[model samples]
Target: MKQNKLIGLGVATMAAFLLLSVNTAEAARTDMVDVSNHNGYMNVSDWTGMRDKYGVKSMVTKISEGTFYKDYTAANNIATAKQAGIYQNGYHFARYKTAAQAESEANYAATLAKQDGLPNNAVLVTDVEAAEQQYTPLTTNDYNNFIFMSTVQKYGYRTDIYTSGSWMNNIMTVKPGTGWIASYPYVVGDKQWYTGNHAWQFSSTQNFAGTTAVGNFDVSQLNDDFYTGGQNTKPVNPVTPPVTNNNQVANQDYAQTGTFTANTTVNVRSGVANNAPIVATYAPGQSLNYNHIYIVNGVVKGRYTSYSGQTRYASMGYIPGGSFGKRSAVSNSRTYTVRYGDSFWSIANRLGINMNSLAAKNGKTINSIIYPNQQLMY
Candidate 1:
């Protein structure tokens, strides 16, 4: 009897140990590494070393800005990182000027990425910071942010917003397509800032797998799927190519329409009427790429060429014609200004206004034009 009892206890102990081992293995499998470029610069060799040594999976390289940090080393870093088989993402340090300015920067960045042939794993991120001295606040910062983020999404690129925890929760109320949180913990048991972020930058300098520098990181491979998730979820919307003779319209399916509020010099093309591509570099809030049609004297201006390339124009006649049309009779009426990571739908929902009414009030459709600093009445 005694021998039998001892045998039973031994069996129970073995079973518990086996179950614990299984649980441990499952937890280890879920661990991942994500890294970003927050410091002024990153050594390509150092980045490569981190990846190899600590299994670093994803990276966000800083690009350009309207501030003193003019040029973005991201393009060069991305090229180098790709050669070594690491996934790369491009991010802009947003110097929030106006909704229109932010949109232009986003559009310009997208154009750059398109020109550069961004990697299959590439994503676009907006880094919102107000540390610089020459910053102006917008009334509808949250609304404008929605426009900027949505515009990036329209370009077939994944989008995310990177900001400090307090800024994310307080100053900006817009929900990003995804979030990259930066919160430095002073104590070991501090609560994390971003609960739904795909990637978290826990500390500035963490020695992981025998490497050091502001290199502490984590990558959620699961988040990669989330970043690109919309590609599968949303049905592809087809765009009608404007009828033009001089230049052949290759693919209008990917064309995006937005008001340009900036006045940077853009390329103005020579041939093609109505939809002629006028590549004009712009200032902060000049309207651009109006659905391959530009309105002059209430008529469609064909195609034009710019320095960047060919762009289609959309005539103002297509925009609700006149402002006098019956203002949308939706339940709520409000206007929102632009911010770093906003979208049209997001703005409408936050203000408790019907999205259709908001779009109609703006003299556009669901995906119509709303530039930075411009007011959209519902």
Candidate 2:
């Protein structure tokens, strides 16, 4: 799902015979799989062993991006695929190309799919194959007039479009039967395709055969009311969480002890959420000598104790220019761009610097791999 490769080949063999026959001679369709956080932690017996070994039923997942990341394994992969009963949906890798950045990335993916449970009228997707929407190439009236009408007239959910298949046949405007596409034909039944869109994907590598979820997933084909019809049930569109508690632990507005630093290579965890349990990482200018900090929801964390004594927590990032527990050291001539859940240690903790001085001032190295508009320089 990272940059979803493969494109042309006679327009993907005329988009696989124009779109609909997932092999086995004809009427076969249904499977699905989309995941994010690069497919990690998929319990519930790995979503019932990928739905009893691939019949898969449904699962789009991803959840948020653009209006500044938010998919720390999207609330436990949408509650472990609803306790293995499957049928999940909620995507948003898009980094918007306007209409007020698609209404603030559709209110940050319908408020992280109503704070990651993604149920009421499921289907949220709009991944639009980013490269910043193939460099502002969003047409089809920017996905049917402003990103699926701002996630269905202000978040009632149920929108689609996952792109590619030559950007849904040459950059957007996609509206026929509707959007999912991807295309990878080396042999998805060797011919007879078709697409008014309901879904295609045709393999990023699919290995449901390795059962308990070993790796190669991305598969798709779907259609039969792709996740139960009636235009996906629409009704519950309330959306509010900019933070009532969000990522919890927010009552300390006071705390004392300072001297933090680890602005880039972070993860000390064992607690402050994002699936905890790291217990130590530190690096980029490391230092972390806290005694207690906390603010959380607005981000700051800190705690510190371990040497095996155990307390842990470290993430003294996000204060922007100093003061919450004192970070302000930056300036190697600050400049960063790489967005959409960036990394190189999150642009060296958002430019406070030192992930090897922002990977040697952008010649790149803390294991590189930056994207979305890429620019980095610190």
Candidate 3:
């Protein structure tokens, strides 16, 4: 009896020590990643396994790049994330030529957010960097940054800026509602770059297996002090996409008037698995036509582009009422302002109007180059 008791006490002591060690290790971690495609392309189906395998708690995927690009992998990744019951948000790669251009990009990105089912609560981050032109001067150039984020905010989406500290202080005058700092090689447990209002990017180009992500992706995490359980500024007025589209899509019996925006920039896989090879990518705010979104267990799922490339699926609240389940209807007589990539042809197709009638009504030549902010009646 004495021997058994002594042995039991020894085991208990060892177990306690091990538990303390584990806790200590956890305590030593100061930064975590808000995962994105910058590290590699992540598939939607891969999220759960990636989350469980890598212990990802919060993340935002790459949705748009500049005024024209969209990430194809966003729909599946976002939808699957909702199904997995995780906090998933989105970010946009900004390339603005002017303040007006900035606002246009923001509006376009917000539309993508709505299409992909990103609610007002999901933080929409603008990735400011030199896309069209490298080395944007601090003076004169930075105001566009504010325009980009402010417009996104104006549209009722929670907005953040992902830029360097020097850029935040020197390049841009007005700071974002949330500042996602990019300070690589952070020391474990040392959050010197962390401000009470900012998240830090500790590393880039890190090799993380199992995600099937391509390229060197960035790893960032929100400051524990400022993290709102990964919630963004909710919109005062949320606009939801229609549940059905007028066009009849091929192969699928049903038609949805609604389209989804790409919340993250990832590669579209051939299968609904992460291990599947990357077949394609989507640009930000690039619209996927009616009835192309996938749904599983009431959560919106993205279809393979090969099977259906034109549309992406949006997400509802993983927590319920994330976007208020509100849908925005297309106005037939409404006027749409032309922006960077606007053409009468594209506009008419987007609005389901006749191109010839639209051009004749607007007195525009078919080959005319429409400038940014130019309004046209469809």
Q: Which residues of candidate 3, in runs, are more than 4 Å off?
A: 1-45, 131-142, 174-177, 186-192, 206-216, 224-378
Task: Indicate the TM-score of model 3.
Answer: 0.47
Q: Estimate each model's TM-score.
A: 0.43, 0.25, 0.47
Candidate 3 global lDDT: 0.51
Candidate 2 has its poorest 10 consecutive residues by lDDT at 233-242
Ten-residue segment with the worst summed lDDT in candidate 3? 1-10
Q: Which model, 2 or 3, shows the larger TM-score? A: 3
lDDT of 1 by residue, 234-302 (tens): 211111123334543322122333333322223344432434554443333444423333333223232
Answer with 1 or 2, whichever has the higher TM-score.
1
TM-score of candidate 1 on Cα atoms, chains taken together: 0.43
Model 1 CA deviation exceeding 4 Å by range: 1-45, 67-72, 115-117, 131-139, 174-177, 188-193, 207-224, 227-378
How many pairs of residues collide in each model?
66, 10, 32
